[model samples]
Target: STWDSQGEFYESEGISKESVKLALKGSKMREELFDHYYAEGGEEAVSDDEMVKYLDDNYLRYKSISFAKTKASTDSSSSATDSSTDSADAANEEAKAKRDEFLEKAQGVSFDDFDSIIDEYNDYVASKKASDSSSAADSNSSASDSSTTSDDTSSVAESDTSSTASDDTSSVSDSTADSSTAASDTDSSADSSSSAPDPYANEKMMNYGTMDDSQKDTANGKILKEVSGMSTDVATAYEDDNAYYILIKGDVKDRDTEYAKDNHEDLLKEMKSDEFQKKLTSWVEKLDIKVNNKAIKRYTPKVVYDKQTEYYSKNNNS
Candidate 1:
């Protein structure tokens, strides 16, 4: 009702009479009020830098109320936890005293004799396991005898049925023989059909250079892209996982000698096998295989890619 007269100013400034009253209570309250104003202002709010400057100027006494509240909360929580811990410790001490008194009353009590007690328990456990195993074996033996008897009865019945079936089979054999001749005729036809010419027969001798415009596709039917040194004479064949090439040597169609000469300007200056081996050895010698001792020890053997062969022989072989 009071806000109706000053409603326009209150709405624009985002400060009602109730809010102003609360804010005037203390500097902390005023800062809280400013926070609410900033949040609600939206488009009417001042720029962030201007807001910060204004807050700095006006709220000089607003000494981080959030920090104070947080510190108070942490202190109270710690105190409560410490009190609970103290009570629990007292309870535990009382329980321990009662246990010690009970133990003192018992005669010939030796805590050090636990090892012997454990050994006896283990022996009992082993005896129980052995007893269970023996019972299971006896049960299995009885089951096996019962199964054998059933199998024998079934076998006798099967023999009688088989004898009857054998008579029927004799009759069927004559008809089967006629069908076998028909199947043999079908097999002959299939064999003749299989003798059809191989589609890839032309591709075996066909090299890239000798291939016509229409036949310039790869073995898998991909379009042939021209490369300067890749000649037609080199017969490419693939089998298993390996690519085999037959290098044809001739006067004009000499792929090996001419291609090498044309493609490589310094073909004569190529590295020899011994020289390459020496270079490889020198490069390998320069390599620093930094084996981190801590790192190697941290991981399990299974996790490591390069496991020692002896580990498998020792552990898995057993």
Candidate 2:
């Protein structure tokens, strides 16, 4: 009886026996049902027996069609959401990769290097401040002393002239007083000149030496060669004063030279090793290198022009 009622309802709703059968024949019944309903108009007449049979055969099929459509719409919405999430994830991954690259570039720099630079800078600033303060005090003291000397000179001149004028009325007194006044003026002038401080005496000369530029270059080269273990000629040519090179020569010289002979190769290997660089970086971080009394937390040395050229040439070749 329920089947019969459903069949009547189907007939009223315009679903036919053939349409019901077609819809039942495939999983894509919702699409087929819409096509069939539209094709047959809003209502299609059907026999009560045929309608009852159709309803009995495809009742679940109609329900399945409805469910399928809802599922498809939900699936489309989910796919769109998933696509957005995937794009976001890809963007995040790209950003993370860039950050990792930056960190890698920043690696090997130690806190000691920063500290060393900072300390050096701070010391330089302190020295400058002290020098400036001393200069100021010296200038102020000189000014005060100059004023007092001028006043004393004026008083002496006034007293000497007054005594001479008074002595003019009495011949012996005038002559004696005039002579004494002249002697006093002469002595005072001499003393003042002798005691006067030379302003230029405190000023330092800028020139370090009279040695020619070529001689200076040669001297610098020798120093660099001794410190860097490079050829004297090459040192002269390149003028490398890197601390790494200096440390290497100082520390590794005994191991590599004929003087040491033993484990020369091993020592050389160690000097040029990454381990040495790491150790140096660690040491620098610990020492906290300061330049001009300023603390340096981070610094990157400029790549040598030769190295940059080599890198570009290699990349181009590749």
Pairs of colliding residues, candidate 1: 209-232
Candidate 1: which stretches are off by over 4 Å? Answer: 1-109, 148-318
Worst lDDT run of 10 residues, candidate 2, spans: 61-70
| Residue 16 local lDDT, model 1 | 62
Error of 2 at 21 (Å): 84
TM-score of each: 0.16, 0.14
Write the residue-wise lDDT of candidate 2 on 78-164 in tens digits.
877677567544544443343243334323433222223223323543554566567766766666667755565321111111101
Minimal lDDT window, size 10, model 1: 62-71
